[model samples]
Target: MAAKSATKSVEQGRNLRPFYANHTPEQLKEALRRMWLVRRFEEMAEESYIRGLTHGTMHLSIGQEASAVGICLELTDKDYITSTHRGHGHCIGKGAEVKYMFAEFFGKEEGYCRGRGGSMHIADPATGNLGANGIVGGGLPLATGAALAIKKRGSKDVAVCFFGDGANNEGAFHESLNIAAVWKLPVIYVCENNQYGMSVSTERSTAVKDVATRAAAYNMPGVIVDGNSIADVNEAMTAAMERARNGEGPTLIECKTYRTRGHSRSDRNRYRSKEEIESWKGKDPIPAFEDELMALGILTQADVEGVRAGVEKDIQDGFDFATKGTNPEPSSLLRGVYTTGDAA
Candidate 1:
């Protein structure tokens, strides 16, 4: 384990170079396919919301696929992940069945949380997904507790907590990082810094130019990456995961990305400019990965189109299954909230 540090510059100087690991052509192809699927799923879900099919507001992960997929690919079945409100990308990357995720969004009984938890609270314990949290910074402590559990169980499993840059402003964020760092818990804190926490920009709230720099106070590795580049995202994630798996400690990774949509269901997003949005859009993860694959002669225009078609069909099937499923019974509303009669 690394010695604890109390200074910011030390942390910054430690891992100035981004981590990179070679991926086979097959693996790269699969990543591109999954990224495409996630983006399509987000678009379809948004359409459902606009069509009055979904009941609640949504937090889309449309433009931030790389960060979610990159970090999640490094996790194992025993390793846990706590997701954010914008959780679809993470859930997909963690291998949660897309059909069930869409079902949950549509409030079906077959959903991940049986339709009770809805979009924001979809969880699958079988896959080690703790669930997506609705409250800002809510999953920070939950993930920390999960890391503590891993320690008690004497396992090598690490907890990956995904949150936005805005979440760093929350007190729970700081508290959890402090505790995890102090105890040397196996947790990787991924801040998907989409530049904005809702409509509020990070610059408006934080004194630090980069959120990763804050990791110094806790004496952990902090890495910043180009969130739009899936390659860069995966490279950084590999290093952080390796560190945690080795019992070294937690890491704070800031992925600088942007969301193509508004803050929530209703925001018009008058705060941000079109030029900024377009600038980030040019760096979209899917296209970047596609370009790389094509450059390596791995993917052609036809292959890309085929992947898009398959993803569309898969998403449509999910929506169909969800809409056809029945809603939950009123009596079952209180289900899973409390433990039933089974004393130890």
Candidate 2:
């Protein structure tokens, strides 16, 4: 068992260079900027919610930024992705404009979905975002359908489904996997296993130590990576997406991450111990990746502070934009409810 574990470590070390070795210093800087944007955006959003500026329950992807950015860095604007309630990072990583996101959060007219979708339901067809679903495991079947649609159209566009460990227990997961493997659809199942399904711990719930092992039941490649390590996630996604784009069916990628915040604002997180939370905080993805960049000479302390200042300014601008924008007119509320025009 010791020898097997040592070999696995050596293989992981070799493949973890996909992001570090391939990208230019400039590219790394931009990637880091996006990660920072996600982190700051969530922080500000939480502040806004506390101040009662944004209504509705919002789930923050506070600690899982690396998984979102790494997988999305491999995607193009034409590729499709579905998200869960904790979906801000995924949307941001897929090139969503923070201005409109703020508008939606504020329920203003300028928002994505025209203030109807808010954070969880925001969808942008222009960017190939099918939309974020509020239901657990909802995106699984939808993503599979999208992959099938792309295959039928003979398009190279692939679909990615970003789900949580909670959804793994749902029937949709197994059903979707069976169909995707049988049809060889171009969809990637990304499980952001953050250890807890709301208040329930994984140890008391999950059947296996690694969710990736479940992929075997469907005859697809299963991969597990450190969700805190940006490079490792990118490397695994590179291989998985490569197989998908090449018409080799789907791959199940389990990113073993954690949620630093409560499952939602109402959650006190009484279910978890303080020691566990602090240990995960020590492994925070943002600072972890920043350290990696510093070691490679791609970033300095000054650069880090500068990036923070820039992101702060940008986030402030988004908040200002949302606060100043007009609320959705009551008369137009029913405008998009149904289509009255011809179908074809």
> What TM-score does each of the candidates earn?
0.91, 0.93
Per-residue CA lDDT of candidate 1, range 153-203, in tens? 988888999998988999998999999999889999999999988878989
lDDT of 2 by residue, 208-228 (tens): 988999999999999999998
Q: Give Cα distance to truth, residue 154, candidate 2, Å.
A: 2.1
Q: What is the lDDT of residue 293 in candidate 2?
A: 84
Top-TM-score candidate index: 2
lDDT of 1 at 91: 87
Error of 2 at 49 (Å): 0.9
- Candidate 2, superposed: residue stretches over 4 Å from native: 1-16, 341-344
Worst 10 residues of 1 by lDDT: 1-10
Candidate 1 segments whose C-alpha is farther than 4 A from its true place:
1-21, 341-344
